[model samples]
Target: MGATDRLDRYQPLVLGLFRIVIGLLFTSEGAATLFGVLDRDATPAGDWPFWYAGVIELVCGLLVLLGVLARAAAFFSSGAMAFAYFTEHQPDGLFPLQNGGLAPALFCWGFLLLVFFGPGSLSLSGVFRRDAAPERRG
Candidate 1:
């Protein structure tokens, strides 16, 4: 098969895997910041903004990982990452390399992509689709 055909055939699998990985990473960050997993410091539960953001990350990340409402989860995640980069990293400098904004920037764009493209064919939504069967002609 041609390269395009091969890519088309495998696109869903690749996209699903990508979504899983991204979700895992985002979830880990939330876990670390909220629950102190992976030897990372836990933000105080009562802390403002950071704690709230962590909650969002945890919940949205889980939704993304399970491919449940992935587009909506990814949309929220993308916005959160953008906010993080702008508020935390951009003050240091305009460039990501100079400001240590790479991770947030990547997450922002990655989630944005997922928001547009969805979780792909390997997702729960795909499996549970109400109209999965092809229409029949009378």
Candidate 2:
């Protein structure tokens, strides 16, 4: 097989690993900001917007990580990143590089990709799927 064929054969594995890493990183950010882990100050108990965003991040991140309703979770996560970038970063400058919006920008696109492509084979969704036919074959 050629390089493309070899890569295609491992697509599910690569996608799963990518999803896991993204989910973990996103979840860690929420945990750090929400609970004061990782030397970051917690969003005060009643700060509704930030607190709620963190909650969404944490929940969606976990869902994506577990591949449970992953596309939906990824859609929401992508929206959150877009909202954060536009509201917080865009106000400072038009470009991500100028405004330090790289993280949100990257996350927005990454989750958007997941929303379209899905969580892949090594996921709870795959295990619990009712359909007997496989979605892909190598």
Candidate 3:
């Protein structure tokens, strides 16, 4: 097959992989929040932000995992990571290693990638394209 055909055939695989990986990562985090596995209230803020973060992670992660609205989910998840990095992780600066804080920065990078690249062409988003072809303009 030609390059175009090959890529088209495997596009779903690529997108699906991205969705699954990111989804699982966020999903586990959400599980942590929903279960209260961590002592969030121990922090000075008393876990107020943790609740919001947990909800976002849980919902967005599941949406992506299900391949439903993967693009939008990924975008918002990226934004969530950005908030974590700037406010919580990066208060000191980009040097995450300085304070054992690479997790948030890494999450931010992953989410940013998801936002720009979009959940690939193999995601539920891709299925939507095939099933919901837009009306052609005159």
Best by lDDT: 1
Candidate 2, run of 10 with poorest lDDT: 129-138
Candidate 3 error regions (>4 Å) = 1-12, 37-46, 132-138
TM-score of 2: 0.90
Candidate 3 clashing pairs? 12-122
Sequence-dependent TM-score of model 1: 0.90
Better of 1 and 3 by TM-score: 1
TM-scores of the models, in the order given: 0.90, 0.90, 0.71
How accurate locally is residue 68 in candidate 2, as Cα lDDT from 0 to 100? 92
What is the C-alpha lDDT profile of model 3 across 40-72, one tens digit per residue?
322232367886788888899988887777767
Alpha-carbon runs more than 4 Å astray in model 1? 130-138
Cα RMSD of all models vs. native, in order, equals 2.1, 3.5, 4.7
Residues 1-138, model 1: lDDT tens digits: 899997898888999999999999999888988998999889999697789788988999998988999999999999999999999999999999999999999999999999988897667877778468687899
Candidate 1's clash total is 0
Candidate 2, residues 27-121, lDDT tens digits: the string is 98889779999889999865866787788888999999999999999999999999999988999999999999998899899999999899987
Report lDDT (Cα) of residue 105, candidate 2. Answer: 96
